[model samples]
Target: MTPSAMNMTKEQKEQQDIDDWLPITSSRKAKWWYSAFHNVTALVGAGVLSLPYAMSELGWGPGVAAMILSWVITLYTLWQMVEMHECVPGKRFDRYHELGQHAFGQKLGLWIVVPQQLIVEVGVCIVYMVTGGKSLKKFHDVVAPADAAPIRTSYFIVIFGSAHLLLSQLPNFNSITVVSLAAAVMSLSYSTIAWVASLEHRRHGGSSHVVDYSMTASTSAGRTFNFLSALGDVAFAYAGHNVVLEIQATIPSTPGKPSKKPMWLGVMVAYLVVAVCYLPVAFVGYYVFGNAVDDNILITLEKPRWLIAAANMFVVVHVIGSYQIYAMPVFDMLETFLVKKLRFHPGWPLRLIARSLYVVFTMIVGIAIPFFGGLLGFFGGFAFAPTTYFLPCIMWLIIMKPKKFGFSWCTNWICIIIGVLLSLLAPIGGLRSIIINAKTYKFFS
Candidate 1:
């Protein structure tokens, strides 16, 4: 045998250590806390901070509806994760592209992942950039009001995002874990901070729209349109499921341990944490602002100079963590298409070239999409909704191959239908808005 095969490799030693640590058990499920925290990490990305502002635009009733619809989309994501695990056993996360291809087809996976990688992931980066920019501006303005400007905000995002990408390429990717943990703390802290701020705002008779459940007993297609349109926003909030694939390679294969539970636990934890974090923020924000809340909550928070710094710090940390997640797919795609497919070698020169391209692309998109809130709305409504909702549902139908279609199958179909209807609703609303005021709202122009 070769020397390498005769000795313990790094991967082998790591696996042995994990096996010793976790041991092997017959349990098919993770403990509640494990499931809870893993999902929470994934959910607390920069998007949660922007949510209250997004919902305020539609009124409290529509905003809450948006939150619930987003959760519905999240439920489908949860179902997909469960189904993927059941079908593929220990390797569901590794074989996400395979699952996509198997469940749908090769072409479908390509379509799904391309936009997922390019638009969804990159768009998310843009959100973080804009959000971070705003947060930094807010922080700076309290101390030096004259120094804040859109250009300065733009510069900060560029520096911040580039630093993350550069740092991620270092040995062991150690900073990723640090950034992730910090992000969790910051997000939770922000939730607490925003809640306190909202309460204080309300105590002083703050006129923000917090309650607007004025639903009419009318089913006119025109009136119900905005509620339907908000489905895309929900889908955008639920788009973190694929994140498991990015970190799946890091999972240790313990000899005695049940393979899938640890990973599944991670996913569920991310979900709960994010859901809890988002809910209160949305509720409190709507309650405080009512109809007048800024599309971004940071704009509406009425805190002292010190508390504002804390909130801004939280936003910055969240953005740092987000860049790591977004970079994974982009790096993978470049490695596949450039180095392997196109026969270019992987080295420092190539890495720098790829990194520069990503920086440029991210900056252009961030600047081009002015008004962070509107960008989220447009992307959520048009891009995220269709990709998350329609594609997944159709793929599940093909993958499950139900003989008589039980309750689970029926529910899956219903979700799919809802997603499709919801995806169509956004553009329909956009079209209607254009028709009403073509000169004013120039979708064509």
Candidate 2:
């Protein structure tokens, strides 16, 4: 230890050691675009793929409205997180759980924020497994001979799941930025391809004879349920809020300005890119396929072998990259718990075994519960509502302590109320849909 470090207390010395160890490299930190790419990559994966199906449920008018509303609310919550991080005294937090501990008490943060964030990350990996396997199978069927025996999606699930498990072994978040950048480009590429394909389909008379744009469902109860479910889908698409702090931590602080400014600029740029990618896919896919769209819009397109194949390839690659990005948090939390709480040293073999097991666990869950839409709704409502919507509002209210009955107070309360309703109603709607479709449901189908 250095002479100055030798004079420090044990706690300060340990903290200093941790701070020195946590950064992936000491040469240079990430640029603004690097942060943007990471954020955009996280925000624009399986969720964007589901937007057309969500739009089908809500129709054009309500669908567009929900998309816009989700964007605004998510952006506001993201900014709230950034603001909270900026307001902390001394050094900034590098993890979401730390920020939670700072805002709420340690107990609440441990019990609430950590687990919810884990769910968001692990849940997303599960979705990626299902999505990757299904997309791979679809692409295979397209090129395979007509007389070939069918291969179950389960096979592809294991294959891609193994691939993801290997990729999950990357040491830290910064190690995966190149993967994240490639995933971001793939996201944009597939989104653009899907959009152009949809437009082309419409030009080639693929548009539905009957295109319904109604805001309400056939029945009042059904309408309410469907609207909430659709809202859940929209919420899930915007669920990257949980990882904003981690992404921000990857970038070095700019000189002579609050770190929040660069963070905010990166976030805005990411959201703008996300909006560009999301709006066209949701709108164009709905326009072409109408209510007949599949949960993954790419599956609905059948023409131009090379183009569709390329898009599906992009989806698979993007998800592979995304699996690592999302899974890193879970790995970090578990490793931290083992080291800090359980008195285990962080070692390479232990890290590999722990992370590999987590990936396998998620893969098993994905294989078991193959109901893609239902899982999205269930987790989005139960976990993401709190993480993405409710908690941020609550944290801001607690930390900022806005005046009672003032604009900020009322707005936050409104968001909180909406989040509660979504949490309760969205699961009901999602589960109802799952039950209604249960007769035809099959594992690995």
Candidate 3:
């Protein structure tokens, strides 16, 4: 029950009923670990596997700097978001757009925040759809007999998407906690497997990997494009900020203690786990494979047949959870619109049709063109960079209105400059990479 259970105003009662029905607000009993694994599940995604490839494009200097900077910058912005969640007493901004509506005003905030947030959420779902499918294919190829007829990658993708048909119908954030926890554990497992496997491969005479550290692209233009694309890959990793508010909404908040305390504690633990999973995978995977590292590190380490198979399966599970984490917010937005704006009744039929349709749409899109690296870069720079890195800072400045030119203003401005640059440059490389992949990639292949 809500804190206002004692109240009995007609409109308040009605609003409480809607809140009870909605996905995010329906549960508020999630503990700190819920925040932990949810953040871990959201933060450390399959994108960590691509860090080596991103590092390769960036080379030693920019690569190292980009990795460290993104972790710090996004962490700072994340703290800002957690603080702002209950900044106004007695009210909680349970969703990202709600916070935006408060900071930018109702109408303007929707326009400013919804499109980018939608792109991030929808884009992540599509990317994970592709990832889940690809990992399945990779696993099948490794364990199955070599002479067996090769399955089309498209078929494996459909099989992977089929899982979501049922999973999408899960009621809300609370319902998926077990799934998220499993996914978070699997994420850590596979990331460890990726780096450890990379090291083992290196120990065994490099297993045909090219060990040179020089930029893979020969031409000046090609290297520049890759560098820009790599920025997107790194940006894609620290994307938990996208769903932080929604995750916090699940935790019970009260006047004396507020939700931010437990939420921030969980975030710190999550970030620590992130550093453990990310830094080793990026540095070790790149150290072993150099410029020739594949976009997904697990794909590169194909030796130790059984372990490699297990890692791929882990990836499949992890991305499934990641896909749901990003999708829940979108579901809330859609259902809220249907019930409130369109006057549709809130019921199981609405959730089934709306959520299923959204999942199927992402599945179709993922099946049609699963350019994994390109999607990461494109979505990361275009939307991830903005939402994860600077959108919160922008909101904080607007809402808090700190003294001009003070340390607070300076820090936010610096973050904004970096984030804005990423948004402008990253998509160019990502789009180019997609076009290049398309030339050789038969549709639905």
Candidate achieving the largest TM-score: 3
Q: Can you give the TM-score per candidate against the true fold?
A: 0.78, 0.92, 0.97
Model 1, residue 302: distance off in Å is 3.0
Q: How close to the true structure is residue 349 of candidate 1, measured as C-alpha lDDT? A: 76
Q: Write the per-residue lDDT of candidate 2 for residues 1-445, one digit (tens) a residue.
A: 9876676777686655544443232112667777787788888877888898889888767789888878888888889988877566666766788878878888987777888898888889998898888889888988888898999888888988999767877777677889988998999999999989989988877654666555445788887776667777877888888777777776676446656777788888889989999999999888877777877888898878779988998999899888887887777677766766786755677777888899899888888777777777777787888888778899889889999999989988988888888787777777776676677878655
Between candidates 1 and 3, the TM-score winner:
3
Write down the worst ten-residue block by lDDT for model 1. Answer: 19-28
User: Residue 176 in model 1: shift from native, Å?
Assistant: 1.4
What is the full ranking by lDDT, best candidate first? 3, 2, 1
Q: Per-residue alpha-carbon lDDT of model 1 for 258-332, expressed as tens digits? A: 435566666656666667788888788766665556656766775666786778777777667666655555655
lDDT of 3 by residue, 1-445 (tens): 5656656566687778878998999999999989998999999998998999999999888989999998999889999999999989999999998999999999998998899999999999999989999999999999999898899888888898889989989988989999999999999999899889888988897856557999989899999999999999999987888899999999999898899999999999999999999999999988998987889888888899999999999999999999999999999999989987898888999999999899889988998989999999999999999898888989989999999999999999999999999999999999999999999998977
When 2 and 3 are scored with TM-score, the better candidate is 3
Q: Rank the candidates by TM-score, best first.
A: 3, 2, 1
**Candidate lDDT values, in order:** 0.59, 0.80, 0.91
